[model samples]
Target: MRLLTVSALLLLLLGPGLALQIQCYQCEEMTHDCATPEFIVNCTVNVQDMCQKEVLVKDDGIHYRKSCASSGACLIASSGYQQFCTGKLNSVCITCCNTPLCNGPRQKKRPPASGAAAPNAPRVGLLPLPLLPLLLLSSTLC
Candidate 1:
């Protein structure tokens, strides 16, 4: 009973803080790497809890925009422009994610196995929040 109470108290205090705090790469540039250490920034807590990345293909070169964003706005923009995300001329792709440093470049997907089709949608990596307090409590208790 005592351990349960302590765990609940820790969760109550840390849950929102952990959920709201996020770090992401922030930059706008063309033909340059933006995922360097200097470009990383902490997103505005509670207000901007997601990382957003925009890729625009233009005549000269590709443009990249990485920054913090609110979940609703980022998701709406991503869904609305999904059709125009084709990797052809004038292609514009926007993706959002919830985990730390998620605005960085995407990792190459592994080929499907046994003729399975690959997924089309971008994967949003989410950090498990509820287990955080439990992990902390366990670490301290042990």
Candidate 2:
């Protein structure tokens, strides 16, 4: 039947389209582990100004990325981080950062002590090295 043929064609063309979705390289937010990351459902990642911070808690972690379309039911890639989205938005860009996000007071990088500084930085106080505890105990005795 002509109707049947058209229906088959439509199904063939549109059925798989529904399975595609956008995937993030490091969606660490959805899944607790990067090995098995989770996705932000029914949402987009705003990569424009969120990549820097691993978890974009401000907007539920979902960005407005457009180029990332998957062949599944709208899924997001995770990398063990956390995120949140306040409303529905698409086409996002995230400003990724190798270090943790700037959450609080920043630790100033100390300038190398002129000549007084030792070649190798010593394991100063309360380190987790093998003999740190023993050294601490010895110092406490003094």
Q: What is the lDDT of residue 117 in candidate 2?
A: 52
TM-scores for the candidates? 0.67, 0.19
Backbone clash count for every predicted candidate, in the order shown:
0, 43
The Cα local distance difference test for each model comes to 0.85, 0.35
User: Can you list the residue pairs that collide in candidate 1?
Assistant: none
lDDT of 2: 0.35
Candidate 1 achieves a global lDDT of 0.85
Write model 2 residue lDDT over 1-142, tens digit each, in one string: 6555655665566554433233333433442323222332222433222222232323444322222222231233332222323233432223332222221123598887786657686856654343444455455555
Expressed as tens digits, the lDDT of each residue in 22-124 for candidate 1 is 9999998646659889999988889998999999888888889999999999999999989999988899999999999988877789767886655785767
Measured with C-alpha atoms, the lDDT of residue 110 in candidate 2 is 86
> Which residue segments of model 2 deviate by more than 4 Å?
1-79, 82-103, 124-142
